[model samples]
Target chain A: MTDNNSGFSDTKQEIMQATYDAIQQHGYAGLTIQSIADNFGKSKAALHYHYDTKEDILAAFLNYLLSEFRETIQIDEDSSPEQQLLDLVDVLLYGPDNSSSEEIFQMQTALLEIQSQSPHKQLYRDQFTQIYHWLGNLFVEIINNGIAENVFRDVNAHLTAQHLLLIIVGGILNRHTTNSEMSPDQIREIVTAQFLPYLKK
Target chain B: MTDNNSGFSDTKQEIMQATYDAIQQHGYAGLTIQSIADNFGKSKAALHYHYDTKEDILAAFLNYLLSEFRETIQIDEDSSPEQQLLDLVDVLLYGPDNSSSEEIFQMQTALLEIQSQSPHKQLYRDQFTQIYHWLGNLFVEIINNGIAENVFRDVNAHLTAQHLLLIIVGGILNRHTTNSEMSPDQIREIVTAQFLPYLKK
Candidate 1:
């Protein structure tokens, strides 16, 4: 079933899912191509035909995750600027709602392992920079709207956005390094305590 | 030389430094025991004599770096609390000034590579947690002193400390990801725009 109809080959997707499962079971260092091949009851040769090395499949998996990231980064066009801003905050801090905290923690840790691969660092940086640039623009628009509506004080939207993004990344980091959540309460308290200084008197 | 002094033999120090230099040159994924040996003009057998595998040497390299980290984390006892505070920020963000920005970038990237190794993650976590914990306590002391002196508004020193440490780590992350400096300007702006809410207002 290479594909009845789709953008990518079905066999490749299946292989990547198997790789994901291997990562889940074995952790990054422990995963072997043989284990991934075993997931589909396929021989190790089946995997070797499609991917030449461990890094090859992991790189493809990163591309898969990045595409997923792109898809989720959007917000409805009609939401109020403040709602849009809050939505962005939620999306950045929380992984997808479907994941259990434990799964989120493990998957994120695995992603960090992939991201740290030496040769692929620039790839990670490029993807990260793109996401950051998008967030920065969204923030600029939100701050401008807030200022116009008298909801936020006059501030440098770019720098403030950069600052908030730093905190958000830090919060995301906690999820991986420990299973710590950027729980709704933490975000609310932070925004009020930290962002409010620039938002209102 | 092994008996000159100190607990570690000179041979061990040479191996660790060779490993450090290998990481600095090749990033983590590219480094091997052979590559590390090449750094010191030693044979792979020399490395094999001390380290059975690449991870063994890396674990040792990590311990070396952690000890080095501990030594540099201190500030002068005579400095005022405010200067002490700034110094902490500088140390966390800038790294040591002697290394070029590119070296700092590569080394931190290598650290991320080590931090992401799944088998050794808890080892890394323990080291990182120790560092963060120390910074947190120091921040608590600094903030409490500032508040007592009426230089900072009253805030929950512990939580505030945690928040600041998160930002510092995030700042440290930038050095690796993009050759970005957590410049003095950025830090000053962050303190004014972000930390000031918790400081005198």
Candidate 2:
């Protein structure tokens, strides 16, 4: 039973990796089931057995990304609430240390493309909704913790969270959409200097 | 010469209006030169005579939108800087009174889709960059005026403008992408309560 479960997980990872590679090479608009299969190093029929359409595979890829994001931003109990919040912002903007800035930008552009389709595609909308909720909840948790610890000012956690979420979302969109000149470090500095003071005790 | 110029501007307005209608009906992804022509109530050949490809017409459409945006968010000399800034935010989120929320959302979704393509389309990228600059400059002007008039705290106008831009951009993306439950009023309240305090004296 353990072996079967491990194998199933392995296959899922492979599919996700293939999807990532295909997207990196062909972009979201240019990607196809066959292209993903090419990256998978397997027959298109094998990929077809798993996902009937490109959207199905892409939906699965979104799930994979969500799980990956969940793992990447796992809250460290040892860190201060403030640190955790900042780290969350860092990951959202610059991505994990393993990925280069260009790679992060590429993936973000592709995600934005998929997001644009969300209004028309229920599957994409559902995944994006989950992502939004998860991020908002994380911010709320950190801010609430900070308040409890007496490290942050007494503020409306939900409202603050919403504000942070908006800034982050806007930063990402502006960065890629307009080819913004603001570096990630510059953004961090802006947040710290302009925004964090209001929250900090 | 004046009559000729008027006729030329009238034709451009017609083309822009038709492009807007086509995008509204078919969306960015589904949009085609033929669809735009169908909405124009003109022959495809007429459109082709002016613009060789869909991209060309869309690029012109973007320019038209930018001009319309500039006109819609015109700064009133009589209003206080604070009022101007707030009004700008209102226009960004809810759009002009002439358009319904559903219409605005549909247009935003289509714009997001085109923005997602900006990375690949230089014309789109240029237009978006110009739009970003125009918006940012408007914010800077308002903030600077507020500071000079003693209505706002002494702050870095550029940084404040950037933050506001980020929030505005983020709010729009979140409102559409997540189908956020936060109504325009709720968003306005949050912005008023959480963000505006930092700016006012």
Candidate 3:
């Protein structure tokens, strides 16, 4: 592996983007190196040369999404805790638009599918575990800050955080499984309008 | 197909039990007719006679679980809405013992795998949709009653119910993905002790 500027990393990003699109469209079971190759107009052998196996590609895909999640997570320090919370919900529930949200829903659904598998379960466990804790800690910080500022009532910061995560997580699962109609606005409305009231004075 | 008695139904139960054991052990991807056949002393041919294809068996397995879930859901009308909520949390998180909760975890894991597939999506959608509505409606009623009785904070019952579902759903996803130690008791405690306080008076 020769080190180079953006050339190798650029190919990697292209591979992952193709993967994300394929998985969203066809799912993990339906996905193959050939399918990913189809997106790039490359042969399956070319895909195999870049990545040895589907597992290798998937591992990279998971890493790609994790990096994206970390990069996009931004919270303004000076904002009210309530505003911060809404920001968190916005990041979790939607992206720039419906199209991005759809991609996210597909990404999450794909991850859950992989997470449930025994072989990948151990492999991906640590990364997701870090994510779980990071979010939990963020919620705890928000709650504690809110209490300190006296804008919200004193609630059990840890439990409240877990509760919020639960709803967000549950909402994510529901997006794929439920037959109900859910647009991006509906999800945001539920988060800010319905779920947020519990924390508000 | 001739109408039969308990004998046929009992055979159906046994087959589904085998399917459950196989899925819990091997996961949906690793699931095979042989794996299920291994559960009973029955051969693959015998299994095929009962189920034409692996899809048939999985479909049956899903239906069996759905019926079991409906049968077990019971509530005392006389109990306070708070008690009802706790009871709901308890049932969702765990059962009388760890084994049952473990089984529930496996069942959910299997369903999630099938759910990610394009073919099985429609078959499972109606059943899951009914379940989503049933649980949401249950939450709405409970919240409405709690506010009426002055036992809970005046929260938007519909949203609150959805939030509660979120925690439970998130917890389910966490059960498989997180490496954290969470027994049935710990999960129940988190729900009752940490998350429950916000709604109670």
Candidate 4:
């Protein structure tokens, strides 16, 4: 019975992977359950067995993404708070190092499309809220840790975190939405240089 | 002949107003040409007579919005650069003083939805690109003026402007996407306190 349950879990994981691939290829606007099934290498009937509608599968996909993001962004307690903060920003801005630029761009576009729908979709809004809260808490914790260690100046940790969150979120949106001329590396350098000085003692 | 031309311009402007009202009421997701026609107080045939399709109407609406934005955000040449900058940020964040909170929120939700569709729609993308460029240039000009007037530090005007733009755009997105506890006035105060000090010499 344990083995059967494990197999079932693996199939669900496969479905999530297929959904990601489908969104990347077709974009959220073009995405359909059939497209996800096509990516899954399964029949539409099989997909319908697990999810009744595209929104149902997409909602599950958001949960899957949040868990994956939580797993991936494991902050190192051993590292200095400053380094941890920079690393977190890097992850948010540049995404995974393994993914090609084209892949990252396509994924960002798909995510923005989903984000645009969040206002109308409660499932997406709930997941995004949770994600934002998780990120904000991480930032606050790091800032507080830095202050405690006497490595950073005294600052309103909550306010500072909100400021940083604004930049990070804005940077991600601007990348796809605006006709930005600066490369990602340029933006990272600018953000680091311009903002970090204010935090130092 | 001039009267006939003026009448033509008036009808187009009226159509744009109807589109705006429709989007605010139904949101971009639920918006249809018929809905716009309903707001227009005209038959669908009249709307079709003016524009062939929904996308065409929306494209024209985007242009109308851009022109209206340009007219609305007029920076006073006589004001201090610092005040000009703050006023611009206020306009972007809080919108016009006349609009109610609910109306502003609904308009933002609709705009974000349209922005999300930008990647797939060239017409929308072009308009957004133009809008961003216009906003960025305005920031750069104000920053440069501040530096020249000895009111601000000798910061890289281009980079500094980009940073400010990131915050502004991000703040707007966060208001709708995240479950932020901060009120608009609170955020305005926080942003002004945290970021402005860095610019002063």
Top of the candidates by DockQ = 2
In model 3 chain B, the worst 10-residue window by lDDT is B1-10
lDDT tens per residue, model 3, B1-201: 122322338778888888888998987778999999999669999898788988778767766765665556666689988888888777777742345655677766677666545224676666567667888887888888989999988887876777677667767777767786445565566567655676788
Give the per-residue lDDT of model 4 (tens digit) for B65-162.
Answer: 77787777889999999899999988877778888888888887888878778777888878878888888899999999999999999998888888
Q: What is the C-alpha lDDT of each candidate?
A: 0.67, 0.83, 0.72, 0.81
Number of the top TM-score candidate:
2
Going through the candidates in the order shown, the clash numbers are 0, 0, 3, 0
For each candidate in turn, the TM-score is: 0.76, 0.93, 0.81, 0.91
**What level of docking quality does candidate 3 show?**
medium
Candidate 1 C-alpha lDDT tens digits along B81-106? 66778778876655776767577667
Question: TM-score of chain B, per candidate?
Answer: 0.78, 0.91, 0.74, 0.90
Instruction: Tell me each candidate's RMSD, in Å, in order.
Output: 4.9, 3.1, 4.5, 3.6
1 versus 4: better TM-score goes to: 4
Evaluated at residue B192, the lDDT of candidate 1 is 56
Candidate 3 vs candidate 4: the DockQ winner is 4
TM-score of chain A, model number 2: 0.91
What's the CA error at residue A148 for candidate 2, in Å?
Answer: 1.0
For B1-201, candidate 2 gives per-residue lDDT tens digits of 112222237776788789999998988879998898998899999989888988888888788887887656788889999899999989988889778988887898888878878878988888888899989999999999999999999999988898888887777777777756656776786678877888899
